[model samples]
Target: MYTTLLENIPMLFNDPTRDFVAGIIDAEGNLQILKKGSIRLVVVNTNVTILSAVRRVLADIGIEIAIRPYGKPKGNERQRYRVVIYGRGNVEKVLKVIPLQHPKFFSIPLFSSPSWGRKSGNERDPRPQLLPPPPGGGHIGGTAAV
Candidate 1:
């Protein structure tokens, strides 16, 4: 079903296509801050066709990405394709077009902040501090503990 829909999507990125990509990001994407505070946007899926369509849509808007195999498939598991938008410039571009509707949204500002990823002296990290674990020590809600 999704393959057919993605295959037929217009090459140009319209509002509906933007919203659809945003939905895909909200569900399957990872807004990652690497160990050195560099930001990366990754959308993972089992279907390469869907990710190919996503890559084309993003390319139309001048954002580039690389599609690669995420992990080795286990028994009976499908191979996962990772569409990665690397570097601050690419991440910033993606954020402008696709507004993430998740708690990860809070991290968006960090990417745009002046202090983010800076190595100068005396400036505190712009990344949000992680909250302490819940009372029971289980995972927090769907959102990360922030």
Candidate 2:
């Protein structure tokens, strides 16, 4: 809602003592509030060579990503990766390294799921999932380097 000029004329002040009063009036008139929801971001087909750089960038930009390093075969050209990012605000600035047009890199919004228990939105932290059983007779998420 906007106020008319005549109705606002009483708010205009020239005396130094009225500065504080004018400020309060302006602040009260201009006050705005926001309503928001959580969002879950998932990074698919990311490049592992830039993982550390990407992590720093995300942290600096106030977004958190769960890092799950997938292994590469011997003599592979570049390390392929899958990272999950979760947040509520715009994160495209932090994801500048990703090629927005290419299919090899993309981000998706992961919605909250009641089945996941403790529903997950863009705000929830991500954990590694669907990893293959380790060789040498062990389970995943152990002390294995990617």
Candidate 3:
């Protein structure tokens, strides 16, 4: 019976193109809202190490993830987890890898992300400034090229 239900669950939502990826990051908050008639999953942690450990477990379960690791808006220092799965029994399987100590779960939704962008510090160097416009047709300081 479970297999039949699982097969019918429609894995299409896991596709990377869908907006649902956002819900996975805000999974904690949006899980309830998105899961109105759908399956929900949650992976919880405030520590980077713990969160990473959870993600690795998911990877091992054959679910390739596109992670958007960043600090919470409230400045609570908790990193968020948002990803997509590529295989079956993912929710059930990932739960097996995570040790019972760390409270993260699949099959139940949680707060996730709406888009993917690396955190500020993690971005490339910001030291170099953009080159000024070309000497000819391009204007500078709001003055027409003279």
Give candidate 3's whole-model lDDT: 0.35
Q: Write down the worst ten-residue block by lDDT for model 1.
A: 137-146
Worst lDDT run of 10 residues, candidate 2, spans 26-35
User: Highest TM-score, which number?
Assistant: 1
Candidate 1 local accuracy as lDDT? Answer: 0.65
Candidate 2 vs candidate 3: the lDDT winner is: 3
Candidate 3 regions with alpha-carbon error over 4 angstroms:
1-36, 69-71, 75-88, 95-146
- Give the C-alpha miss distance for residue 37 in model 3, angstroms: 2.8
Per-residue CA lDDT of candidate 1, range 77-116, in tens? 9999888787666766676666667666453344335344
* Model 2 lDDT tens row, 1-146: 25685554443322212233223222221111112232233433334433444454555546566667555746855554555443323333322332234221222212233222333454533421222222432211112222
Could you tell which candidate, 1 or 2, scores higher by lDDT? 1
Candidate 3, poorest ten consecutive residues by summed lDDT: 29-38
C-alpha TM-score for every candidate = 0.63, 0.28, 0.32
Of 2 and 3, the candidate ahead on TM-score is 3
lDDT, candidate 3, 71-132, per-residue tens: 46565544554443322244334333323322223222221221223457577332222222
